[model samples]
Target: MTAFMEPFRIKSVEPIAFPTAAERRAALEAAGYNLFKIDADQITIDLLTDSGTGAMSAAQWSALLSGDESYAGARSFRRFESVVRDLTGFAEVLPVHQGRAAERLVLSALLKPGQASVSNTHFDTTRAHVELAGGKAVDLPAPDGGNIDLVRLRASFATEDVACVVLTVTNNGLGGKPVLMENIRATRAICDEFGVPLTLDAARFAENAYLITELEPEFTGHSPRKVAELMFRSADIIWASLKKDGIANIGGLVALNDPDLAARCRLELIAYEGFPTYGGLAGRDLDALAQGLLEVTEPSYLRYRAESARWFGEALRAVGMPVVEPVGLHAVYIDAGELLPGRNLPANALLAELYLEGGIRASELGTLAFGRVDPAGGPDIPSARELVRFCLPRRVYTRSHLEYVVEAAAAVVKRAEAIPGYRIVHQDPVMRHFTARLAPML
Candidate 1:
């Protein structure tokens, strides 16, 4: 494998706190053993999330200076619009504060009561938003990879009132695996056969495109931008959290060709988010997002971004950790269930242990995140897999920082058998992992 270096140099820096072991223990207890509740000041190397935690480029900073701060019809919005339209080929582009807001706008407008929104795997927020709109969220993951089960998807239209089909490129909920281009084409064909609209949850579109150039022979030698355009061509709608691939600290967008649907979503946007142009974001944020969109598709940057995550995953797997195979661009997922066999709340247990081993905070993406509670007091349904995600923020953290993570993980593995399990003592009805309180099952 060829060694890839960071394509750009760091021009700014922030100090990280190195809390002592006792301080970490105190912080963990205070946070109720929830990594999300832990303060950033207590974390030495925060891998909790890749969302809105990236480092911006000098160009993005320069773009910020030129932002036209008008309440309506700002030049910043125009710049953002042009870039999105050029990339997505969508006539109607609606900006929002973030991806969930965009998901809320689109799902609210499209889903009727008792309808279903289907996907390969719906991320936590997307699933919640669907239910909030009085619709059901259905997932039909492929047996081998991140592709939607095409047979089940086609059959779903026959049996269920599917409002829309969402295809999350580089499926985040299922180990961040990239969906094959052929799968996208097949799904589009199926959607056309049933006359149902298809939406691409394109948060990591650039990373997915870069992987296509590497993995698919048909896309071999193609530029990431061209591959991205090809991927966008298959979708009737596209919504993205720009914080991931856009390399900006904040921003998101919803783009589609349907005029009536766009009009309906804009109404919701006005009622909830903001005006059509600004959409709950400042002019400076729009400008930064515009610049970041352009920068994200560069081949060198995408190469480094994908390879660094792969490097980290491979390193951990070499040390007896069961990492999710074929690491995705933004994160490396570990199979916590396998790591701590027969242990209750294995993912949550590993999460607490990681923080204690080193001030390294990561997110659990398994039972606590996706499992359902039995209202009748029966056994709680568990998620398909118990996973802990070490999400890498864009253009942040050096290789040395990752090395420290490896060392910490190695330590955990050395004493894996002694790591205690946990049980949730309190949790919210929806998205419980964010604020759930847990205790050790010693």
Candidate 2:
């Protein structure tokens, strides 16, 4: 491979296919319905969780699993704190379990009835938590939902009920699109203007930082570390999933400048979770998280993941399948509309069909993206049945693995595209894609 070209290629490998439902059932039983079924020559490409396993050093693992919860547990806490400070340059850090846990805690501390949270964009969990707390989630008038709107956000801050502003890096709803840096700085100015705190939902922070500084070198003078610091500095509280940023199994951190708010979050942790020392994270997991955080900052590491997604996307596009243009590090979205007229199948059914094919996983925008939606009987938000998600877990699969997925997906889209009116069944009871029950016009 050339210096600029990655050695990875999905076409180089074979896709794993089960010959019968019984074998498929056993595979799901063993691995538990993860992306493991998407196999390569040697390993599976697991884009399911951002938490990268096997990244922790021996010393870090030893410290995390020691399990002696004293103020000296403060050392592990301090180690984590230093990591946050080194990467984000933030002054405070509070450990939490998973990304949504941090969101719930942060809002629990900050939200009140009638309070407003302004954001360039929001993940489903973030919006739900804010509304659950009786605070209104203002989607902050982005020029498009994919981009942030600072002028409208600043104006919203004029209200006394505005509690905080959130910015989700690499906006997940719009296929992981990111807000521009200038927009971020502008939002910071607006937050300052109204004295409202700006909190970053940094689940994808590592990837966003990498893209802004590296992939798009027009903004390269700033490293991921530098951009992270800039974003952190703008926030009163910054919270990110250790799963995504550190690449650990399940962990998150919430950092804030206010001592009072931090204390309040800790109190909630006591009631809901157990204690601050071990917030649903194994000590070994924390060590892994610490190690993963360091790995994500490397240019080569980010480039590897970015290139893999690009490679798969290219193959799909070459086959005439519509996909979200490559933007971030993780998943590639297969736009269903290109195959079916006006997304005729609906996301719910599309996800089901993809799973029934040799492939065992996927998602849709209208229903599965948020996982929760309360439709108003009146005029509705654009019911976009966007694309089927193919999330790639970091460091798990390789070139050959990527090819297998591309090949299988290409075949599936080709076959499924010909079928008409296959019903989308919502087994999860939460996010339903397309139901044969809903009229085609709906």
Task: Name the best candidate (by lDDT).
Answer: 1
With a 3 Å backbone cut-off (N, CA, C), the pairs that clash in candidate 1 are: none
What is the lDDT for 244 in model 2?
Answer: 69
Residues 371-425 of candidate 2: C-alpha lDDT, one tens digit per residue? 3334654423344445566667655565676676666666767776454433222
User: Model 1 Cα displacement at 220 (Å)?
Assistant: 0.3
C-alpha TM-scores of all predictions: 0.99, 0.81
- Candidate 1 lDDT over residue span 1-442, tens digit each: 5778999998999999999999999999999999899889999999988999999999999999999999999999999999999998999999999999999988988899999999999999999999999999999999855889999999998888998999998899889998889999999999999888999999999998998999899999999999999999899999999989888888899999999999999999999889999999999999999999899899989889888998999999988789998898999999999999999889999989889989999999888999988989887799999999999999899899999999999999999999888998899998899999999988
Off by over 4 Å in 1: none
Which whole-number lDDT from 0 to 100 does residue 144 have in model 2?
A: 47
Give the worst 10-residue stretch by lDDT in candidate 2. 432-441
lDDT of each: 0.92, 0.64
Minimum summed lDDT over a 10-residue window in model 1 is located at: 1-10
